[model samples]
Target: MKTEDLITRLAAEAPATAPISGGRVVMAGLLAGLPALALLLGLLGVRPDFMAAMAVPVTTLKMVLPAAIALLAGGAALRLMRPEGRVGLAGPALAGLALVALALVVWRLVALSAPQIPVALMGRTAPQCLFLLLGLATGPFLAVFWGLRAGASTRPALTGGLAGLAAGGAAATLYALHCPEDDPLFFVFWYGGAILLSGLAGMVAGARGLRW
Candidate 1:
């Protein structure tokens, strides 16, 4: 057959929609394992003292992990879901801005105050304000992944959100285990904060990235 005819035949045979595979399972497993790993790390005494004046850098590193994980996983998942689609850079950028704005609005509306900024933030000794800022900065990259996952699947937004929540929660739980600060306030503020921020970021990304 001629090359053009062969190409046309191949195109005709391809399914209009890609086959559903085990992508969700992989996402679920990653979501579930993060917390478990953190617990394991904690048991192994991998605590970093963020309270120490000189430990600022170390604490910052710890704070950035969740965002980094989200970005990495989300990016990979997006590519897998739609190999032909381009990355949703704009989605993440918008989501990141929205995340920060929403956080500030909540802070202002509630007039909430922390007991001690560091202890209340991540339960570690690092500067809570600085860590939160860093988390906000990393929101866009992670949001891209969330957006991709939501867009790729036929699943509902709620389902996608739950998956994202699971991923974020699991990661936060693990981070808490390794952290020496056992304050509920810290988890509520920092860990919980991370999940909520990431979720919103995901929503924005999904809305943009999941276009046909």
Candidate 2:
């Protein structure tokens, strides 16, 4: 067949409706998750010193770190939705930030009095951090997965996992406002672990659900 004739024939058969864009899908997921997060935050209440804490670098970093992770992961997820897309630097970027956080914690702990080490590592809310983060992330996870369902991701598992990271990271950012645990150690262990767990869940769900 002539190339021009074939092209014309294929174009005529194309579906009239345009597929939803990745940005729109992710935006919808984010919107879907917002109400749930806001409601949860309302119930839990923001820290009394939230405004004051914002001036502190340590306090600010807690939210900054997760926000960065969410941006990177969400960007990656959007890219991965395209069949030819690659993860690029998102994974490494997350690892680097995590390492920086860990190093800071270790340095701070080393300089602390031996007795302070325990207290710093085990902040008052350490136990609650894990559950709270995961709980808050639940809505986003479901929302993002629903968004992923509309995408034709070649790397479904990876895309889902990134989406999970985005969701968890976002939840953590908001949770940081209410979380009184300012110690880096607490963040590195609990906050980081929770985000990882969310990614793992996404991986499993994507592997099972993102198939064509």
Candidate 3:
């Protein structure tokens, strides 16, 4: 067979529908996890005083920080889905946001007396926060990863890590409504730890599965 004819035949055989965009894939992933996250929230029950707590800047900041991270990281993940896409400002933006969080944590730490430091850091729900944040993020991560599988990503680990961090951050934001731990020290360390853990898992998975 002539090479031109063979190429034409293969092109004709391609699927008629256009593949979904990375933004759509990320949105779909969020939708996919909504029901599960809702169920988890229902089971845990939102803290009765969430509204009041939200009115407090310090307490509400816990939610805002994670939501911001999710937004930025999710955008970065989509950008990386394209072979030609560069991370651009996403890396430095993420770093600056993280630094802001750490600075808040440090400020909170200093505000506490020496004896109160340990209790504030540990919080009553430290372990539960970690487990629930990771668990809630699982479905989103899997959905995002599955959706991105067909993309010609040149930076798989970064793509997957951002997706994972996005998933974890979103879940953590929702989880905050249910979580009683409002201290910057506690959530910054434990909640941030959970998000990073998700990013690590995605990095490993991307290394194995996202390679073309």
Candidate 4:
């Protein structure tokens, strides 16, 4: 075939543009995940003391930190969906979160006795926190993976991992309502662990699912 004829045929067959942006996809995933998360919360029931506890800075921060992480990670994931986009401020955001957690720990520790330290660090739900967060995060993670699947991400695994981080962070925000453990140390550890685990899972999923 002549070169001109071949070009015309290829152009005719080219796909049309997508209807949505990466941000919209991420938002869809988040929205889709919300119902399941709400059900989980309803089933688990919010802490009886949550309303009164929210008055405390530490308790409030428990909700705020994960929400902040979700926002940052969502922004990163959206950027990562583009073939050439980078992770921009997400790294610094996470680092800042860690520093804040560290400061909270230091502040709390200065006021507590040695005997109370262990009890504070290992709240009654310490053993269950990671597992609960992971379970809560699963639906959101899957939804995020679905949302990102059609993206032309150069680093699929990394993008997926960031999506997982976003999902886990959202889950943690929901979980905080039900979690009575107000210790910063516990939040920093178990909640962080759960988010990390979800990120790893996303990495693996992205490697497999996001492959073009």
Tens digits of per-residue lDDT, candidate 1, 1-212, equal 99999999999998887554446544545654544464456555445653562255434433454445445444434444544444346346535634653564465335536545443544344354334333333433343344445445533342334335435644553454345654334434556566666556555555555444
Candidate 1 stretches with Cα past 4 Å from truth are: 1-11, 15-18, 23-45, 48-123, 126-163
lDDT of 4 by residue, 1-212 (tens): 99999999999999987654876676777677777677767788888999899999777988898889888987898887778789987889888997897798888789889999898988999877888788888877887788777777888888888888888898899899899898787787778788888888998998888878
How many residue pairs of model 4 clash at the backbone?
0
lDDT values of the candidates?
0.47, 0.84, 0.88, 0.84
Please list the residue runs of candidate 4 whose C-alpha ends up more than 4 Å from where it truly belongs after superposition.
1-9, 109-111
Error of 3 at 107 (Å): 1.0
Backbone clash pairs for candidate 2 read: none
Q: Give the higher-lDDT candidate: 1 or 4.
A: 4
Which residues of candidate 3, in runs, are more than 4 Å off? 1-9, 15-17
* lDDT at 209, model 3: 83
Compose the digit string of candidate 3's lDDT tens values, residues 1-212: 99999999999998887865976787788888898778877798889998998999888878998898898998888877889878789889999989998898889877999999999999898888898889889999999999888787899988888888999889889899799988899999988999999999988888888889
Best by lDDT: 3
Estimate the lDDT of model 2. 0.84
Measured against the true structure, the TM-scores of the candidates, in listed sequence, are 0.42, 0.87, 0.92, 0.87
In angstroms, the error of model 3 at 18 is 0.6
Give the best candidate by TM-score: 3
What clash pairs does model 1 have? 74-145, 147-205, 147-206
lDDT of 2 by residue, 86-121 (tens): 889988998898888878788878888998988888
